[model samples]
Target: PLIVDASSDFFSRKIDFSNIALFYGGVQKNAGISGLSCIFIRKDMLERSKNKQIPSMLNYLTHAENQSLFNTPPTFAIYMFNLEMDWLLNQGGLDKVHEKNSQKAAMLYECIDLSNGFYKGHADKKDRSLMNVSFNIAKNKDLEPLFVKEAEEAGMIGLKGHRILGGIRASIYNALNLDQVKTLCEFMKEFQGKYA
Candidate 1:
Protein backbone atom coordinates (compact mmCIF):
# COMPACT_ATOMS: atom_id res chain seq x y z
CA PRO A 1 0.00 0.00 0.00
CA LEU A 2 1.13 3.50 -0.70
CA ILE A 3 1.87 5.46 2.48
CA VAL A 4 2.86 9.06 2.91
CA ASP A 5 4.46 10.61 5.97
CA ALA A 6 3.76 14.30 5.62
CA SER A 7 4.91 15.28 9.08
CA SER A 8 6.08 18.76 8.19
CA ASP A 9 3.66 20.03 5.55
CA PHE A 10 0.52 18.15 6.43
CA PHE A 11 -2.07 20.91 6.84
CA SER A 12 -0.35 23.86 5.28
CA ARG A 13 -2.26 23.47 2.01
CA LYS A 14 -4.86 21.39 0.28
CA ILE A 15 -3.75 17.99 -0.98
CA ASP A 16 -5.15 16.03 -3.88
CA PHE A 17 -5.81 12.68 -2.27
CA SER A 18 -7.60 11.21 -5.30
CA ASN A 19 -5.37 8.19 -5.70
CA ILE A 20 -3.51 8.17 -2.41
CA ALA A 21 -3.78 4.96 -0.45
CA LEU A 22 -2.82 6.44 2.89
CA PHE A 23 -1.78 9.80 4.25
CA TYR A 24 -0.40 10.29 7.72
CA GLY A 25 1.43 12.87 9.76
CA GLY A 26 2.24 14.01 13.26
CA VAL A 27 0.16 16.79 14.78
CA GLN A 28 3.11 18.58 16.35
CA LYS A 29 4.35 20.74 13.51
CA ASN A 30 1.53 22.00 11.28
CA ALA A 31 -1.66 20.23 12.36
CA GLY A 32 -2.15 20.75 16.08
CA ILE A 33 -0.67 20.22 19.53
CA SER A 34 1.84 17.47 20.06
CA GLY A 35 1.47 13.86 21.23
CA LEU A 36 -0.78 12.65 18.46
CA SER A 37 -0.86 11.72 14.81
CA CYS A 38 -3.51 11.87 12.10
CA ILE A 39 -4.07 9.29 9.45
CA PHE A 40 -6.23 8.79 6.40
CA ILE A 41 -6.32 5.38 4.81
CA ARG A 42 -8.44 3.99 2.05
CA LYS A 43 -10.95 1.35 3.05
CA ASP A 44 -9.34 -1.07 0.64
CA MET A 45 -6.04 -0.69 2.45
CA LEU A 46 -7.67 -1.55 5.77
CA GLU A 47 -9.01 -4.74 4.25
CA ARG A 48 -5.46 -5.87 3.71
CA SER A 49 -4.85 -5.85 7.45
CA LYS A 50 -7.96 -7.82 8.33
CA ASN A 51 -7.47 -11.44 9.35
CA LYS A 52 -3.77 -10.73 9.76
CA GLN A 53 -1.68 -11.58 12.82
CA ILE A 54 -0.57 -8.02 13.40
CA PRO A 55 -0.98 -6.53 16.84
CA SER A 56 -4.14 -4.51 17.45
CA MET A 57 -2.22 -1.29 17.74
CA LEU A 58 -0.32 -2.04 14.56
CA ASN A 59 -3.32 -3.14 12.58
CA TYR A 60 -5.11 -0.42 10.66
CA LEU A 61 -8.16 -2.62 10.32
CA THR A 62 -8.37 -3.04 14.07
CA HIS A 63 -8.41 0.71 14.66
CA ALA A 64 -10.86 1.22 11.85
CA GLU A 65 -13.16 -1.45 13.22
CA ASN A 66 -13.07 0.09 16.69
CA GLN A 67 -13.53 3.61 15.36
CA SER A 68 -10.06 4.59 16.52
CA LEU A 69 -10.87 3.65 20.12
CA PHE A 70 -9.10 0.34 20.27
CA ASN A 71 -7.02 1.65 23.14
CA THR A 72 -6.42 4.73 25.24
CA PRO A 73 -5.98 7.71 23.00
CA PRO A 74 -4.45 11.16 23.22
CA THR A 75 -7.75 12.81 24.01
CA PHE A 76 -6.33 16.21 24.75
CA ALA A 77 -4.35 16.19 21.56
CA ILE A 78 -7.41 15.28 19.57
CA TYR A 79 -9.34 18.15 21.13
CA MET A 80 -6.56 20.52 20.24
CA PHE A 81 -6.52 19.21 16.72
CA ASN A 82 -10.20 19.96 16.49
CA LEU A 83 -9.57 23.47 17.74
CA GLU A 84 -6.81 23.88 15.17
CA MET A 85 -9.21 22.78 12.50
CA ASP A 86 -11.73 25.32 13.70
CA TRP A 87 -9.09 28.02 13.48
CA LEU A 88 -8.13 26.93 10.02
CA LEU A 89 -11.71 26.98 8.88
CA ASN A 90 -12.26 30.38 10.42
CA GLN A 91 -9.27 31.63 8.45
CA GLY A 92 -10.86 30.43 5.21
CA GLY A 93 -9.28 27.03 4.84
CA LEU A 94 -6.03 25.74 3.42
CA ASP A 95 -5.78 28.26 0.61
CA LYS A 96 -5.48 31.11 3.08
CA VAL A 97 -3.09 29.13 5.23
CA HIS A 98 -0.89 28.43 2.23
CA GLU A 99 -0.86 32.12 1.33
CA LYS A 100 0.25 33.10 4.83
CA ASN A 101 2.91 30.41 4.93
CA SER A 102 4.20 31.46 1.54
CA GLN A 103 4.42 35.07 2.68
CA LYS A 104 6.31 34.11 5.81
CA ALA A 105 8.78 31.96 3.89
CA ALA A 106 9.25 34.62 1.25
CA MET A 107 9.99 37.25 3.89
CA LEU A 108 12.63 35.03 5.43
CA TYR A 109 14.21 34.13 2.11
CA GLU A 110 14.31 37.78 1.17
CA CYS A 111 16.16 38.50 4.39
CA ILE A 112 18.69 35.79 3.63
CA ASP A 113 19.12 36.91 0.04
CA LEU A 114 19.65 40.52 1.05
CA SER A 115 22.14 39.78 3.81
CA ASN A 116 25.10 40.64 1.55
CA GLY A 117 26.79 37.27 1.92
CA PHE A 118 26.41 37.27 5.70
CA TYR A 119 23.68 34.63 5.61
CA LYS A 120 23.70 31.80 3.09
CA GLY A 121 20.60 29.70 2.65
CA HIS A 122 21.08 25.95 2.45
CA ALA A 123 18.33 25.22 -0.06
CA ASP A 124 18.19 26.42 -3.61
CA LYS A 125 15.47 28.99 -4.36
CA LYS A 126 13.48 26.45 -6.34
CA ASP A 127 13.57 23.85 -3.57
CA ARG A 128 13.13 26.03 -0.50
CA SER A 129 10.53 24.91 2.00
CA LEU A 130 7.75 27.03 3.46
CA MET A 131 7.97 25.22 6.79
CA ASN A 132 11.66 25.58 7.58
CA VAL A 133 14.10 28.24 6.46
CA SER A 134 17.66 27.04 6.98
CA PHE A 135 20.81 29.08 6.54
CA ASN A 136 24.35 29.59 7.77
CA ILE A 137 26.58 32.43 8.74
CA ALA A 138 28.54 32.83 5.57
CA LYS A 139 31.11 35.21 6.98
CA ASN A 140 32.18 33.00 9.89
CA LYS A 141 30.77 29.50 10.21
CA ASP A 142 31.89 29.23 13.85
CA LEU A 143 29.48 32.00 14.85
CA GLU A 144 26.38 29.86 14.28
CA PRO A 145 26.39 28.67 17.88
CA LEU A 146 26.65 32.22 19.13
CA PHE A 147 23.84 33.20 16.77
CA VAL A 148 21.62 30.52 18.22
CA LYS A 149 22.46 31.57 21.76
CA GLU A 150 21.81 35.23 21.10
CA ALA A 151 18.63 34.44 19.22
CA GLU A 152 17.36 32.55 22.25
CA GLU A 153 18.33 35.46 24.43
CA ALA A 154 16.28 37.69 22.16
CA GLY A 155 13.25 35.45 22.74
CA MET A 156 13.45 33.67 19.36
CA ILE A 157 14.12 30.03 20.15
CA GLY A 158 14.63 26.91 18.04
CA LEU A 159 16.90 28.47 15.43
CA LYS A 160 19.65 25.91 15.72
CA GLY A 161 20.04 23.50 12.80
CA HIS A 162 20.28 19.74 12.75
CA ARG A 163 23.60 18.36 13.98
CA ILE A 164 24.45 16.62 10.75
CA LEU A 165 23.75 19.78 8.71
CA GLY A 166 24.93 22.47 11.07
CA GLY A 167 23.36 25.88 10.46
CA ILE A 168 20.29 27.88 11.42
CA ARG A 169 16.80 26.49 10.84
CA ALA A 170 13.78 28.67 11.52
CA SER A 171 10.54 26.70 11.58
CA ILE A 172 7.65 28.85 10.41
CA TYR A 173 4.74 26.70 11.34
CA ASN A 174 1.03 27.49 11.09
CA ALA A 175 0.90 28.93 14.59
CA LEU A 176 3.71 31.37 13.95
CA ASN A 177 2.23 34.74 13.01
CA LEU A 178 3.60 37.10 10.41
CA ASP A 179 4.76 39.50 13.12
CA GLN A 180 6.89 36.78 14.67
CA VAL A 181 8.53 36.21 11.29
CA LYS A 182 9.18 39.92 11.05
CA THR A 183 10.76 39.73 14.48
CA LEU A 184 13.01 36.95 13.25
CA CYS A 185 14.04 38.90 10.18
CA GLU A 186 14.71 41.94 12.37
CA PHE A 187 16.77 39.78 14.68
CA MET A 188 18.69 38.52 11.69
CA LYS A 189 19.52 42.06 10.64
CA GLU A 190 20.51 43.16 14.13
CA PHE A 191 22.55 40.05 14.70
CA GLN A 192 24.38 40.54 11.45
CA GLY A 193 25.16 44.12 12.36
CA LYS A 194 26.56 43.08 15.72
CA TYR A 195 28.72 40.25 14.37
CA ALA A 196 29.33 40.94 10.72
Candidate 2:
Protein backbone atom coordinates (compact mmCIF):
# COMPACT_ATOMS: atom_id res chain seq x y z
CA PRO A 1 0.00 0.00 0.00
CA LEU A 2 1.20 3.46 -0.86
CA ILE A 3 0.63 4.99 2.57
CA VAL A 4 -0.12 8.46 1.22
CA ASP A 5 -0.03 10.71 4.25
CA ALA A 6 0.77 14.25 3.19
CA SER A 7 0.36 15.42 6.76
CA SER A 8 3.20 13.06 7.74
CA ASP A 9 1.31 12.71 10.97
CA PHE A 10 2.51 9.15 11.45
CA PHE A 11 6.14 10.15 11.70
CA SER A 12 5.68 13.50 13.40
CA ARG A 13 2.77 12.84 15.75
CA LYS A 14 2.23 9.10 15.89
CA ILE A 15 3.81 5.86 14.62
CA ASP A 16 6.47 5.16 11.95
CA PHE A 17 6.65 3.71 8.46
CA SER A 18 9.74 1.62 9.12
CA ASN A 19 8.25 -1.44 7.47
CA ILE A 20 6.50 0.15 4.52
CA ALA A 21 7.74 -0.85 1.07
CA LEU A 22 7.23 2.56 -0.50
CA PHE A 23 5.51 5.88 -0.11
CA TYR A 24 5.10 8.83 -2.47
CA GLY A 25 3.19 12.05 -2.72
CA GLY A 26 3.01 15.04 -5.03
CA VAL A 27 4.72 18.32 -4.21
CA GLN A 28 1.59 20.44 -4.39
CA LYS A 29 -0.16 19.34 -1.17
CA ASN A 30 2.28 20.84 1.30
CA ALA A 31 5.55 20.85 -0.57
CA GLY A 32 6.29 23.34 -3.34
CA ILE A 33 4.50 22.61 -6.64
CA SER A 34 1.89 20.46 -8.27
CA GLY A 35 3.75 18.50 -10.94
CA LEU A 36 6.69 17.14 -8.99
CA SER A 37 6.52 14.11 -6.72
CA CYS A 38 8.68 13.02 -3.80
CA ILE A 39 9.13 9.29 -3.48
CA PHE A 40 10.56 7.13 -0.71
CA ILE A 41 11.41 3.48 -1.19
CA ARG A 42 12.93 0.96 1.20
CA LYS A 43 16.58 0.32 0.24
CA ASP A 44 16.31 -3.47 0.36
CA MET A 45 13.11 -3.44 -1.65
CA LEU A 46 14.71 -1.21 -4.27
CA GLU A 47 17.78 -3.49 -4.52
CA ARG A 48 15.55 -6.46 -5.23
CA SER A 49 14.04 -4.67 -8.23
CA LYS A 50 17.38 -3.67 -9.78
CA ASN A 51 17.21 -6.50 -12.30
CA LYS A 52 13.69 -5.56 -13.40
CA GLN A 53 13.01 -3.89 -16.77
CA ILE A 54 11.40 -0.73 -15.39
CA PRO A 55 12.11 2.55 -17.09
CA SER A 56 15.01 4.58 -15.73
CA MET A 57 12.61 7.28 -14.69
CA LEU A 58 10.69 4.75 -12.61
CA ASN A 59 13.79 3.13 -11.24
CA TYR A 60 14.15 4.16 -7.60
CA LEU A 61 17.94 3.83 -7.75
CA THR A 62 18.18 6.42 -10.50
CA HIS A 63 16.71 9.00 -8.16
CA ALA A 64 18.42 7.84 -4.96
CA GLU A 65 21.85 7.45 -6.65
CA ASN A 66 21.64 10.93 -8.16
CA GLN A 67 20.13 12.58 -5.08
CA SER A 68 16.94 13.53 -6.92
CA LEU A 69 18.90 15.26 -9.74
CA PHE A 70 18.49 12.42 -12.22
CA ASN A 71 18.00 13.90 -15.67
CA THR A 72 15.98 17.12 -16.12
CA PRO A 73 14.51 17.32 -12.68
CA PRO A 74 11.91 19.90 -11.72
CA THR A 75 14.50 22.37 -10.58
CA PHE A 76 12.09 25.14 -9.71
CA ALA A 77 9.86 22.84 -7.70
CA ILE A 78 12.86 21.43 -5.89
CA TYR A 79 13.97 24.93 -5.01
CA MET A 80 10.53 25.77 -3.76
CA PHE A 81 10.51 22.59 -1.72
CA ASN A 82 13.80 23.62 -0.14
CA LEU A 83 12.60 27.16 0.46
CA GLU A 84 9.33 25.94 1.96
CA MET A 85 11.16 23.50 4.17
CA ASP A 86 13.35 26.32 5.44
CA TRP A 87 10.28 28.45 5.97
CA LEU A 88 8.58 25.73 8.01
CA LEU A 89 11.67 25.23 10.14
CA ASN A 90 11.80 28.97 10.72
CA GLN A 91 8.24 28.73 12.02
CA GLY A 92 9.31 26.02 14.53
CA GLY A 93 9.43 22.81 12.59
CA LEU A 94 6.86 20.05 12.15
CA ASP A 95 5.54 20.21 15.69
CA LYS A 96 4.41 23.79 15.24
CA VAL A 97 3.24 23.11 11.72
CA HIS A 98 1.22 20.09 12.82
CA GLU A 99 -0.29 22.03 15.69
CA LYS A 100 -1.40 24.79 13.37
CA ASN A 101 -2.80 22.28 10.91
CA SER A 102 -4.74 20.56 13.67
CA GLN A 103 -6.21 23.86 14.80
CA LYS A 104 -7.20 24.80 11.25
CA ALA A 105 -8.84 21.43 10.63
CA ALA A 106 -10.63 21.57 13.95
CA MET A 107 -12.16 24.94 13.13
CA LEU A 108 -13.56 23.72 9.83
CA TYR A 109 -14.70 20.40 11.25
CA GLU A 110 -16.35 22.15 14.16
CA CYS A 111 -18.11 24.42 11.73
CA ILE A 112 -19.41 21.43 9.81
CA ASP A 113 -20.29 19.36 12.86
CA LEU A 114 -22.18 22.24 14.42
CA SER A 115 -24.23 22.91 11.34
CA ASN A 116 -27.23 20.98 12.83
CA GLY A 117 -28.03 18.77 9.84
CA PHE A 118 -27.14 21.58 7.47
CA TYR A 119 -23.76 20.08 6.54
CA LYS A 120 -22.42 16.54 6.51
CA GLY A 121 -18.78 15.48 6.56
CA HIS A 122 -17.64 12.89 4.02
CA ALA A 123 -15.43 10.96 6.39
CA ASP A 124 -16.25 9.69 9.80
CA LYS A 125 -14.81 11.98 12.46
CA LYS A 126 -11.91 9.64 13.14
CA ASP A 127 -11.05 9.35 9.46
CA ARG A 128 -11.20 13.01 8.47
CA SER A 129 -8.29 14.33 6.45
CA LEU A 130 -6.13 17.11 7.83
CA MET A 131 -5.16 18.29 4.36
CA ASN A 132 -8.54 18.19 2.63
CA VAL A 133 -11.93 18.56 4.32
CA SER A 134 -14.50 16.83 2.12
CA PHE A 135 -18.18 17.26 2.93
CA ASN A 136 -21.70 17.88 1.74
CA ILE A 137 -24.53 20.11 2.86
CA ALA A 138 -26.91 17.41 4.07
CA LYS A 139 -26.42 15.60 0.77
CA ASN A 140 -27.96 18.58 -1.01
CA LYS A 141 -25.95 18.15 -4.17
CA ASP A 142 -27.08 21.38 -5.84
CA LEU A 143 -25.67 23.48 -3.03
CA GLU A 144 -22.13 22.21 -3.50
CA PRO A 145 -21.57 23.87 -6.85
CA LEU A 146 -23.15 27.11 -5.67
CA PHE A 147 -20.94 27.06 -2.60
CA VAL A 148 -17.88 26.69 -4.80
CA LYS A 149 -18.96 29.54 -7.04
CA GLU A 150 -19.77 31.96 -4.25
CA ALA A 151 -16.58 31.00 -2.45
CA GLU A 152 -14.57 31.84 -5.58
CA GLU A 153 -16.39 35.15 -5.84
CA ALA A 154 -15.44 35.80 -2.25
CA GLY A 155 -11.71 35.44 -3.14
CA MET A 156 -11.24 31.78 -2.10
CA ILE A 157 -10.48 29.36 -4.92
CA GLY A 158 -9.90 25.60 -5.39
CA LEU A 159 -12.70 24.72 -2.94
CA LYS A 160 -14.19 22.13 -5.17
CA GLY A 161 -14.88 18.44 -4.67
CA HIS A 162 -13.34 15.52 -6.50
CA ARG A 163 -14.86 14.85 -9.93
CA ILE A 164 -16.42 11.53 -9.06
CA LEU A 165 -17.26 12.54 -5.50
CA GLY A 166 -18.86 15.86 -6.29
CA GLY A 167 -19.37 17.77 -3.06
CA ILE A 168 -17.49 20.41 -1.09
CA ARG A 169 -13.74 20.22 -0.48
CA ALA A 170 -12.08 22.85 1.63
CA SER A 171 -8.38 22.00 1.35
CA ILE A 172 -6.66 23.86 4.15
CA TYR A 173 -3.03 23.00 3.58
CA ASN A 174 0.04 24.01 5.61
CA ALA A 175 0.33 27.26 3.66
CA LEU A 176 -3.09 28.49 4.85
CA ASN A 177 -2.85 30.25 8.15
CA LEU A 178 -5.39 30.53 10.97
CA ASP A 179 -7.07 33.72 9.79
CA GLN A 180 -7.68 32.23 6.36
CA VAL A 181 -9.17 29.10 7.89
CA LYS A 182 -11.41 31.23 10.09
CA THR A 183 -12.53 33.05 6.99
CA LEU A 184 -13.45 29.73 5.43
CA CYS A 185 -15.40 28.66 8.52
CA GLU A 186 -17.20 31.99 8.50
CA PHE A 187 -17.95 31.55 4.81
CA MET A 188 -19.32 28.09 5.43
CA LYS A 189 -21.60 29.39 8.13
CA GLU A 190 -22.83 32.20 5.95
CA PHE A 191 -23.41 29.84 3.06
CA GLN A 192 -25.33 27.49 5.34
CA GLY A 193 -27.55 30.29 6.55
CA LYS A 194 -28.27 31.45 3.03
CA TYR A 195 -28.98 28.05 1.51
CA ALA A 196 -29.38 25.29 4.11
Q: Which candidate wins on TM-score?
A: 1
**Scored by Cα lDDT, where does model 2 land?**
0.80
Off by over 4 Å in 1: 51-53
Regions of model 2 farther than 4 Å from truth: 1-15
Residue pairs clashing in model 2 are none
Candidate 1, residues 111-175, lDDT tens digits: the string is 99999999999999999999989999999999999999998999988999977888999999999
Per-residue CA lDDT of model 2 for 47-161, tens digit only, reads 8668658888888887788987788887788888889788888878878888888999999999999999888999999898887889887858778889999999999999889
Q: After superposition, how far is residue 135 of candidate 1 from its true place, in Å?
A: 1.3
